[model samples]
Target: MARADHWSDTEIALTVADYMKMFTLELAGQRYNKSAHRRALLKLLNGRSDAAVELKHQNISAVLRDLNCFWIPGYKPRSNYQEALATYVEDWINSHSDFDRVSQAAVKQPAFVPTGVEFSTLLVETPKPSTTIQEEHPPYSPNRAASKRDYVAQEARNSALGSAGELLILEYEEYRLRSAGERTLANRIEHVAQSKGDGLGYDILSFETSGQERFIEVKTTAFAKETPFYASRNEVSFSADFQDQFHIYRLFEFRKSPKLFSLAGAISDHCQMDPVNFICRLR
Candidate 1:
């Protein structure tokens, strides 16, 4: 199989379309087989091998991550994707209003105790910084768009979904502790956001298997895995103060079947932590 240095426009478009279809199915809680999709894609691509198509799918994943949109979970995002690919993905998103509509549609809450569950851990990867900064589009700019679908804004506004996600995590924490024979520690688990207030930098208070206290800050979204989240100055400061024990349980795809990935230690080490807002007052 010969490796092409660059993908043609038609190939990129076809790949993006296939990737989005899989992503939509995953979000809708519909089952899909990646190999089947790839085999189907091979027909459109001109003699492209399965591995080549797989890499292209990963490139599509990277582009979606840049756009702050969801990508198929099976293809882990890989960086250094072509700029043209990003443009094609952005165009597809802008043209398809239904994508945003379906993504934002209300989802039924998942069962309290999820049965037949398989957990896969996602380690947050450092997003490859764009070399060429494209002009800002109103809503869907890869960097910062003013659009309503802007993940950062959407996440801030969806309080009901956020709270629901936190409750799910609380259940998981208690279940985890009890399963490990830490029944007393499980009982001590507190939903600090409810008990004390949101002033505390963290949300739930659980413990390590060693019985050491773990300060957990839960950031959840009903959208994709790479959706951006807001963290306050207080939260950042608290994480720095308690780096050893601080953990961020990032819950995504919450409205349907919820899944999570965790970030531990100092926030600075894991996230870019850009300052998106400011507090100003009359002096």
Candidate 2:
């Protein structure tokens, strides 16, 4: 065993990297729920915070999972990172989900893959399973289906009052994606959603002038006046909990042409955010 004091910074970072990969595997369903996983991690790392433990291990994993990643949760829960990441990579292109197109998109265009010291050490403890795994095909799969069905779909469905309410939302994504890719806007307004490895919710991201990062949970609706969108128990709690870093991006004028006006900071940071459904209106 490498003595604690003797572990070089690179080695230590690698160790944390390994832990992150394992955790991502766990999120992916890799199956190492050591009876005392968190405790064991703390002991192993000599006492690091849970978030730090999570970040250190799988920073990219967290990002992919948090915002809409290649893979979304699917019919069968992910058992390991490889399978989970594969699901995202494949995008359940083969599964019967709302975002078959999106899933297939990821499969065709693979994004992040682990590398160098991070890659070798992380794979060390991962178990190779014997059971034959079932994955979705090229354009439709469980991961994509589950993601839309489980999380974002219902809200979208409920808010889709008519054709106009509908077209704007889908178009808005295209609009944002196109806009985000612009060389000018890319640096200033980041839209990449960090994956929610632990299911903490939010869909988009923005950076503020204060050198602070803001997580924007976008809500789009065709409701005539201000519309209210449903948030998960986790989403609401996360906003209320992280009073400083979170904000709500209300996309109104969605039917005509999508327009966004943000309610920056916690539900209360600006004014009282009624405990009722999160309403989409101007500042």
Q: Report every candidate's CA lDDT.
A: 0.73, 0.41
Check candidate 1 and list the clashing pairs.
139-147
- lDDT for position 197 in model 1: 95
Candidate 1 structure quality by residue, lDDT tens digits, 1-283:
6566677888889988888877777766688998898889999987788888888787777667656556676576666576777778777777776677656553323324334444333234434444545433322245323133544455555667667767877878887888899999999999999999996889999999899999999887766666668788989999999999999888876655668878888788877776766889989
Residue 155 alpha-carbon offset, candidate 2, angstroms: 5.0
What 10-residue stretch in candidate 1 is worst by lDDT? 137-146
- The lowest-lDDT stretch of 10 consecutive residues in candidate 2 is 117-126
Q: Write the per-residue lDDT of candidate 2 for residues 86-151, one digit (tens) a residue.
A: 333333223324344433332233222112212111111212232635433232234343444322
Candidate RMSDs in Å, in order, are 5.2, 21.7
Candidate 1 deviant stretches above 4 angstroms: 1-3, 106-148, 209-211, 222-228, 252-261, 279-283
- lDDT value for candidate 1? 0.73
| Winning candidate number (lDDT) | 1
